[model samples]
Target chain A: MKKLYGVPGGEVLELDYPAVADYLVQFLRRELAWRGFEKGLVAVSGGVDSATTLALAARALGPENVRALALPHAESSPESLADARLAAEAFGVPFEVIDITEMVEGYARLRPDMTPHRKGNVKARARMIVLFDLSVAYHALPLGTGNKTERLFGYFTWHGDDAPPINPLGDLYKTQVWGLAGELGVPEKIVQKPPTADLIPGQTDEEDLGLSYARADVILEHYLKGYPDRYVEGLGFSPAEIRRVKELVNKTHYKRHLPTVAVLSSTAINEFYLRPLDFRIELE
Target chain B: MVRHAIVQLAPEKGQIRRNLARLEAALAELAEDRPQVVVLPEAFPTGYFLQGGVRELALTAGELEEALTALYRRVWEGPLDLVIGFYEKDEREGAYYNAAAYFELGGRGLVHLHRKVFLPTYGVFDEERYLSRGGTVAAFDTRFGRAAILICEDFWHSITSTIAALDGAEVIYVPSASPARGFFGPRPANVERWRELAKSVAAEHGLYVVLASLVGSEAGKGMSGGSLVASPEGRLLAEAPVFEEAALVLDLDLDRLPPVRYDNPMLADLKSGLPLLLNDLKRVVEAL
Candidate 1:
């Protein structure tokens, strides 16, 4: 048999902007509305992912129906806080600010010796608490903003940044998000800014991952397409880059799934029962 | 000239009554000056992707007729034929099938029933786990012409469509609920792929093709809806917009059929060559 499948090299990361924009907009509007919530909310972290997500939601269900919430800790960059506001203002959505410093500090002081890594996790979860709490108060659907790159690398806090029911940018890689971020009317300064989680001071996502997104995204794409390591290396990527993406993806497999359930019966939720993810039964 | 319509719909998941009511409303909105044939997307009465829920939702032909007659009588007191995909229960076989049924409202209530032959069990699909594979591959007589139905995955395989063509099916209606996956192309890659498939199937067999697809999202998976109709020569008559609910109504000229088949003659040639094929198949079976 001839060679049937291989890496589609030309413009692999390129997207059909118009078609993609319509699909994303419709995705948010239709998914949220069917569940009886016309409103949507996104936790803007001053990153391209959240900004793109916010813009999509605004386009889907008018900006008035979408809320932009920025939860900032004391250690978070002031620039991040300002940029989050810029994103919210650019889209004309109401921006709500909450200082998570007091909440995270409550737990941090108990374990004063907790490393910056643990502190970062606490800050992320604290923001999630505010997000879900407001979801009920505002009657808005919580939309996840984590990009595919961050998700595959397991860079996000488990159930913290990835907890929302609907996500427009979850399928897009970080590199691809930049392309869409521009078309969605996001500010140039915000789109060009170095990506970060903004949980800790002086932190850059590239620095933390030990690889830039440009290098990581290509490696991840080729790797996921079942390209051999040798073939990926021929594409001008270093072995370390390929290994870094592969290891992180394998290590964080559990983060991509729901909690493991021990199947004791034939009918277990998400195990043997196997209901469609969106399956709903209208009750009397 | 037959007024054929593909009503692109986004059904509420697992809501049989609501979906049927929605379909009824869509049909009522169409022009009633002429008799029309309408095709609804796969699983039109109930939403697709009902994993274990298929067993509970599957209805016998009698039960489906009972529900639709009550609901659809409000739309067309005149002649209005319908084609729709649904989950079917076979009481005699005690099996559940992903089936598509054709109805001639003015005449026979149920003309043909085609269960999906291919149950895609790979990647995002779990059809084999829930649906029994359909055994028959033949066409039936309709008020319009000899017609056949191919559910979503059934259309992907060429042999299934070939069998219908060989059985003298002059018109093929495909009701699908395919999800949008790829973004590298100018449209959803599936949209482009379906366009090519529609063209190829219509041109090869010299048959009129109508595709009705579902729109809307379920748990963030958007059912890509680009419902379309192609002429016997593979010319696109009409296409609905993607990711939104829209109706694609067009006039189909069955008179053009004689000229189209005369030009291609692929189906006639196929009929002439079928005996040789059966002989070869029998030899292979004997060797096995």
Candidate 2:
């Protein structure tokens, strides 16, 4: 019998929910208001990550000021849509349902022989277009829903679910996100349901990744903390699984950062042109 | 064996009565467990980050004595001890010090006071402007063996713990009102750093280390609690929750401390080298 991460006998990683919630809520409210925004828009996918982000947004910007959108496609799950609706209603925030089947089909019509993976990307980008347009019209900042796990694995569509100006769940693992979802009073069904991208029919995150979040999170956490692969494997993970996870992380490294620009001058743009957040002009 | 309780609390800003009342409630809750010693976070009576109002929030020696006398009579029923942090006013010198005071249940009331030797004046701290520095570090006898208390930044310097251990202290109590910082993953990096600090002190000194940290937000700054206890071998025995008010009571087997000092002899090395180090220091000063 092997020890599973986050299980009864395994090492448990947990968040101080009340503290995190308060910090995130206060951070969201303060940072957005500092940037001259009074409202926030979240794309609720009926999954735990998006639902958790939506709840935090509502708590930060007041439910009346927070807006949710459920973009469903022909291959989308009906239960997911219902869950999204339940989340919006539970938070007392106004939400709209936009069917993106035809919109996505318009892009698919260009390349009829496109694969499901490409189609998923098109759908994801189309959803972002709608979200950004809504954000501009409503004068709300678009909130990101991608968690650390999906981001590390590059499981999300670049510039689609990943392009939100501000993300509250970006620092949380999928397993940690479930813990936060429960703390935020998300529906038990949504919290317990299999996580999905809803990009294609019958696609589940764990099934596609070939590892459970509970198992992968331990490896990912150790990897991020600069633990060696062998050390992570020593924690009861199979070598193949660890290698696969490391490869995914390495291959997707480009997606995690901005595109590099050729440096031609004494001071590079990123290094010197931009002022650091803590840089002070006047000493007190 | 000693049963100790670490109370991670959020003191109301500048509200001494309310904070004391909350402490009383927490003590009441712990009464059933009958912990012999209770440790509270730094500035437990007055909230941390008192910029210009340190004098206003500070308790004079007489005032502190009166308050502790009342509190001991009101709270304890037996031989209980307490270690708490507060802002102190030395009326004779008309100076303020960030201090920790130890009190026995029915004994001489305020038995010992350790004024913080290190005043942090950088980043979010501006202690030097409002506080007068203490010039000495020493440990005293306590109900829980020889014990010493260090308030917040004082414990950050390894020498403070070394000095206390050299002074025959068996246990070091660190009460901190540290703000929560850094989001690496699930937990705050600052809380993890505090745990490492406690562990190092315990391992190096071969003595028990208890750290009681403040929780909750004050003036938009969140204090990461996660109060914890470490054995002499630097093993974490129990930890309270972070960012929330929690009372943790753990029975520590003081008799089972490892002979780390005898085996490792780091303390002995420092003691043997002290005379030469002091003579060299005096020679350098004379030459300068």
Candidate 3:
């Protein structure tokens, strides 16, 4: 599949996950076995994506070696917690429930007028705080749970949902999450649950965004397929939704990049140079 | 010991069933030699389209059951396990995932299926829309060792490997259908970076790394092919020729590994904890 990280239409190399995980396991064990970490820690929200990550962690490190930290806010559904536990236990990993209701409440009460965006940001950040704390206490790397779908739309709070010491599942999309989750033995309840932020009560991700993930994903799929904008409009999406998403794509373009600085000198380094881009330049 | 091969095969444009058939034939031919384990590259069945029509080309877990399961059962001369890349639809769940399926010899059947976790967003790969993200991290049990699977972007992140190590994998195999890019430089030198990363990840974790890269062009991009097996010490034990198709077999002494982290004092120290000093340093730099 092609990825856009500032560069337009860059192709990504594909690897087999088990083989990659096998190699990765050896690397981590040799590097961190003596580091006193008894386990690996990840924040799972009962969603297929996180559940998949948790399963990977457990399988790669062993159930005992993997731990799930569920940081739920007051508005988060009870089923979300149940799903998280179901996934963790199914994978044979340890589970920890850290209700962030108090923290979210404290922040909300402290700032009653906080905008939804700001409140969402707080909820995400609060969850991360708990996750990081758990990681430190456990001496585990904080595994990130954001997927390609969320990352593509800039749907996550930076340093909040996106923050992690290391992310194993960052390259996958929302749809793929379900695929791997089933293979990894994730419970059906979590996989079937409609995608949600669970930041506020009565909020489904689609309702908040004014588009179904399926539709948004189809749009994204077509956009990546190199369809022109006019062709996209023929698909019967509301102009407003298209405009909002397109505006999002434009405005959030910067989110996909390292901050650009005015070149003060002749040579400015970029990931482009990691392997001479000249080689990648098509010969005339 | 059972010799194994993970071929990173990229097919000619728009030939899904044919390519898969060719793969099955090639694998069956190899099976005649009695290799115990085999792995194939990502999206090998439909090819890595990275764009539209992938959903149509993608295979569901059930659809794959007949082909892959039968292949494993039919090809087995001895104890063998196989992992292959395919696009899988979960009809029950009503979702599609970039999936890898595992089959064991003697008709053991459906060992595991894993989805690609890390979807790259920074390059010619736009996997975000084509596939859903997976949430689990674990190893598939293998006779060779406690093995695990990861697809495409999963290796870029360190977590997948690290967790695999702690879980008890002695060897890590990676199957890749990386589109080749022609370069003027020493191609091996170019591949050395990935080798270094893989070796470092392996050596630090003290496990063997086996990589299989796709040969030939797929769609428009060319692959830089050089599949190699590395030792726990990060030394190349055997390697397939670059930018071409070849199968390499090498003996690995799992016994040679340090046995426990005890042999590597660095491991113990690392486990003690990352220095608080580093966090402080990072904070200071961020403040600026």
Candidate 4:
């Protein structure tokens, strides 16, 4: 029930990072207590979001209970691995770095005409494979590193950075990520470095989206806050930018719900399936 | 093409050591086909338990690592990988986490670990009270194909599935330990959920989804064990029985599936007036 950041364009609310962290830990522990999971696996991207997760996970679960996986593509910055190692050391968790460039390139070669989007997806998925493999090795839950800001903007690769047993930071905004990093004592270097996917050379997340985080957050705030489209348009945004944001919101909207199913029968499966599985009534 | 098994076993309370022995026997049966991989249910060692004093039921980090390594090494003759779920404590951080650990046949010594992501706060789940949520999505490489995992709730969540598929997982394995509810009884709601989730996610992303669930009852909850495999187009390839423990084997031709986004083109076409339509729909529906 706790949130790390305020809704965009809404009144800003103060968040207790440690309290939030404790809440998250308790949530996982209780969930695992029910699910019966004790070990946890974290995939470290050498980024602020993942670093904060590692620290939180270490605090909630002992460092010995946690294992860190570092997955790198050949195109990944060299410092990426080093930063992930630094995070692992800080948490005193076991760490391993698996290079996935070869596998990704092999797939690209098979589909020689693959687009940049497809190639980017390959890199993302390859990293996921490494994480699951490690999860298997350590018998731990695979941690998800995606934050709310990225999910809101549709900035992540499907299935790759997205899959995990639990996502500790799904609700946090990018800025709140900074706040948590400071509160958790994450390295300032990772916190300050330009946020890039490192998917390709000289490519950053903002450049790919053709907008800054500041503007995107503002636009997202307006949209999520129920501001009229015209009112948001009146904020001196470009026609193309407005269109892009609107398009992203619409296209990725499906990402927000359980897939919709059309109903024709009197006792429709949709009505029955609307509830989460665990919430369903007893059979017989 | 590869042969894989989704093993649904009965997990009992306070029987980590014994439950693992039963799993060892299941592996023995699955190994006959010389399987490339075997996917087990979530928290196979100890059945799902949310009541008080459950933390003591979790295994120590060292015991978990040693036991899993030995199991994978002993059961598998050829190249094999096992994705198993268990409970472990982080000694330094002084916290508990719900984790899935991987045992690669070789001495990889813990290839990856994922802390559970989407902890369900409502219903029979009170995960918020016990475990810490994981923050990173993870994938792995294997001889069969690229793989990744989503423990239980992560499979139900959208972004988690999207990230795994987008990350290049030819096959994504979901190790689940969902309880059976009476309303959706006879048919496991979790199985249907996994079926729907796999269909939507795989069709949208173009990948195979393998869901392995724990069968039988543990403590007060009955697990909805219906291990199933779905193709990228959302086709049901194979599935195991529900309520009872069994291993569901499936063969996937990763090469035959069409590219999810490129070939289908629905996601790509959303750049048009799709947003306006959806927003209007949301407004109309919510207003009423």
Candidate 5:
């Protein structure tokens, strides 16, 4: 029998920008409206991922319905703030600046020996608090901007950037986010900027993660697609890099889920008490 | 061995004449390949976004037969078969159906008309409100080989594909007009999801699964055109570009079908387990 299969390892995975943009816009609009809200709030950090999310939201629920919040701290990059403003103006969405330095400092007063990581966590949680509070005040849902790479590496603070009700960019890898940013007409400077959590001054994402997002995305894509470690290594990835990626992904598993409750009965809340939407209760 | 041509089109909404013209032009272009079988996207004649105007856009059974016969005479030669999707008006029942018809060149008329069994009424789809459901699934002998036709949502249900395969379908043609959705990574998420479905069906059934999806946008919702041809061994033979109009011609080797089915006897296992499944189903229903 003749082999009809094409050559192996030649498949190229790419996005159709126009189609993807249209789909996401429609999806966001439908989901938000279905949940009984017409407005959305997106925290813009002036990075490609958040900018893309903000643009998509604005396009979905008109710019008048989308609000941008720039929560910057004393240690935050000034360039990030400027870029956030630039993005807001470019997309014609209303934005507000909330300095989080005082909030972070007030929390620091409680513990004088706070490490940089812990301080970053405080800033992240403080921003989320502000965003959520404004979500209620503005009658809008808070949109998450964390990309797939950040979520996989546990780069986001739990209950901080990850606590938003809706996430449009959560599935996009860091590199793919840049592609979408270009398609969404985000400012070129922001799209090309080095990705940073902006938790602290002078800290870059690549330096903190110890690898470039391009390499990390490739490794994570292969790993997430169920490729064996040996096969990924054969595709020009170092074993050490693969091990690091796997460890980060494994360690972050807890952050992706809610706290587990003990199950003592058949009708445990988490297991048996499924989501309301899952129930097939029909109206007569 | 048979060469199949899968045409991915972006039909104008509610414009049957223009859409047919476009399809005729595509068939004329594809004639150079001399494909034994040609498949087009679902609802290519009247487009997929027909809600209130479906009855107006639908074709009576005889009208559809006449249109197809005319099209076949214009573009096809000896033994060239075409599988195309349209909205068929059931004159006797006074209802409409999402249907696919198989036309063999130099034959009497439409060899088979498979109505879509699953009419999705969920988000973005109000098919049930506009069209009645199909009731049968069977495979028939074609010029290429034993083949079956399935409309978009019909192939999503695994049981439909299983029944087709059990009825001795060596090749399953799925014509879809699914909109593009979700971009999780480099690839469109909807396309990835479809790939998983196609691969599972082809691998388990040990037959070729050919999908031809429509492209273009309607009312701001876009259809990602990533038509695919998967082998019995669950390998992708050819994949067309997404969100673009393209015709893919792939030469399929039918000789590999027997060896693949021998290696993986999934069908045999399913056939053996049917009695037990039926018994359990009866018991469960009775208890309920």
Candidate 6:
């Protein structure tokens, strides 16, 4: 029942898409150059997040240097593949379609009664394998397509969807991705389509999350700003919806980070160790 | 007409030699046009996000001065004064500071070094974790007049300018290296926010305010370069473009300061309340 584009209080989620586009374009180019990379690789699903990431990569590193591939399972909708191609073509980037059905089925045989979710995880992980191997073969950095709202909600498959080394859309929320997708000239069919994992028939992201992205982003924004539950409830969200989002974020916190390490030394990898950028040579 | 320039530099992370080389090149070129004073953004030698890396990268005041003068003497020299920021480390004291130093290239060298007082530790800034907090905020004498230098976070507090203005400062140079964030319009929200702060500070103290900010992306966090100069009446004289390396120069009419102060008289009013404020501050400090 909430509005599609804005938070209840005001234009909290509103961004200057042009400025953000320029900043992100610069961010990609500089980050790529810092790590001695000249190209970017992205796994495009017919979804807005991947399309936006692909478009940004194409714009930042040129269409010829960016690689876009759709890794689809047998159950993935035909329109999803078509839309993925449409996204890559819209930006003049090269595209390919990889059938991950055989790879996912190999695991299904070991456990005949594997749930649909288990199969989905296998498919997602299979795509990650193809993406990383292709990245190594092509010498391109793999770009992650996960958005902030999904990351905070823990809606992505751990180690599968979150395995990429770089992400342009990881900081942007789902609703913001939709707005950016429109700005990047992604196809209307792709932008307007209901977001889904394409694992099961007629499955949409909202159906699983039990709340629309428009509503969830507003709630998440307020919640992150340290607003109490009572305050968010006053903004027209129900108690049950609030609790579900909170629980998902809390329960799936482990999925967001690298493996937790026991602190054994003064310079533990992620614990006490400083960022490499901090200790880089000063002669440059 | 006392002319000045602010260079919005994009100092690379952990690259002191390259950063110093860039500064040397800028100063060499700037001498031709001949601005009496020049200001550069904060952390002109190393980037602002150096956490534990500060210890390895910091330079002594004499060491930096030697580096610049070595490159500068070959190019040009005149009645030029340079105010630049650096990560300062004192070997004798075994201490490090985020400091801004004012150098009189044509006359007495190393005029003043103002260490940052407010090292912000909240929301994307982790300065307090790696830097030693500065204690004093005082104005020093220049050929133009009394001037003071304030590093990035120190300017966030009104007391820094209050101390400078009371110490008979006519101009305050704020060298900042803030990351651009919070987008809402054609520009980053920082563009608007910085202007508002500059104008308010200039008007409140009836003094000229020069804001020199950095530009570049370090690990994807961008420093929007919108360096600017404001008049005593809170009017923006010139602003450098955001997110690019550029310089803004202005000619100031020093005669404007007295009239602005005469009309507003806010500083004059505060002079009478100093004792009360000092007493209250003492009580607050004792309690803490």
What TM-score applies to chain A of candidate 1? Answer: 0.94
Q: Where is model 1 more than 4 Å wrong at Cα?
A: A1-11, B31-33, B274-288
Highest-scoring model, DockQ: 1
Assess each model's interface with DockQ, reporting 2 decimals per model. Answer: 0.67, 0.03, 0.01, 0.01, 0.05, 0.55
The 10-residue segment with the lowest total lDDT in model 4 chain B: B181-190
In candidate 6 chain B, what residue range of length 10 has the lowest lDDT sum? B71-80
lDDT of 1 by residue, A222-283 (tens): 88888899998998988888898999999999999999988899888887787777787766
lDDT (10s digit) by residue, model 6, range B64-183: 877766766766666568888899998998999999989877578889999999988998888877788999999999888999999887888888998999998899999998888888
Task: State the local distance difference test value for candidate 3.
Answer: 0.67
How many Å off is the CA of B144 in candidate 5? Answer: 27
lDDT of 4 by residue, B1-288 (tens): 877878888765556767778888887777767776778878777766633334566665567768866876787665567777776677777667777776665555566677788877777787766777878886777666778888889877776876675566777878888876422223544567767887787776677888888865443355777788887777788878766678877677877655554677644454444555778868987999
Cα lDDT, all candidates: 0.87, 0.84, 0.67, 0.73, 0.84, 0.87
At residue B239, candidate 2 shows an lDDT of 91
Model 3 stretches with alpha carbons more than 4 Å out: A1-284, B73-75, B182-184, B188-190, B259-262, B265-288
Score candidate 6 by lDDT: 0.87
Off by over 4 Å in 2: A1-22, A25-54, A57-284, B258-260, B280-288
Evaluated against the true chain A, what TM-score does chain A of model 6 have? 0.92
Model 5 lDDT tens row, B138-161: 999887679899998999899899
True-structure lDDT of candidate 4: 0.73
| TM-score, B chain alone, candidates in order | 0.94, 0.93, 0.84, 0.86, 0.95, 0.95
lDDT (C-alpha) at residue B185 in model 4: 29
Q: Model 6, range A1-284, lDDT digits (tens) per residue?
A: 87678645553897878778888888888778867799999999988999999999999999999999899888899988988898899998899888998898878898989998888888889999999999989899999999999899888888999998778888899999988888889888888989998876678999999999999998999888899999899889999989988987899889998889899999987677666452486543
Residue-level lDDT tens digits of model 1 in B68-160: 777778767876788999999999988999999988776789888999988888887889998899988889988777888999888898888
Question: How well is each residue in A1-284 modelled by candidate 2, as lDDT tens digits?
Answer: 99777734444467777667877796677557645799999989999998999899999989999999999998898988999999998888899999999999977889879898999999899999999999999999999999999999999998899998778888788998998888899888889999989898989999999899998889998887778888887789999899878888999988987788888886676543542221222113
Interface RMSD (C-alpha) of each candidate? 1.7, 11.4, 16.7, 17.3, 12.8, 1.9
- Model 1 alpha-carbon miss at residue A108, Å: 1.2
Residue A277 error for model 6, in Å?
A: 4.7
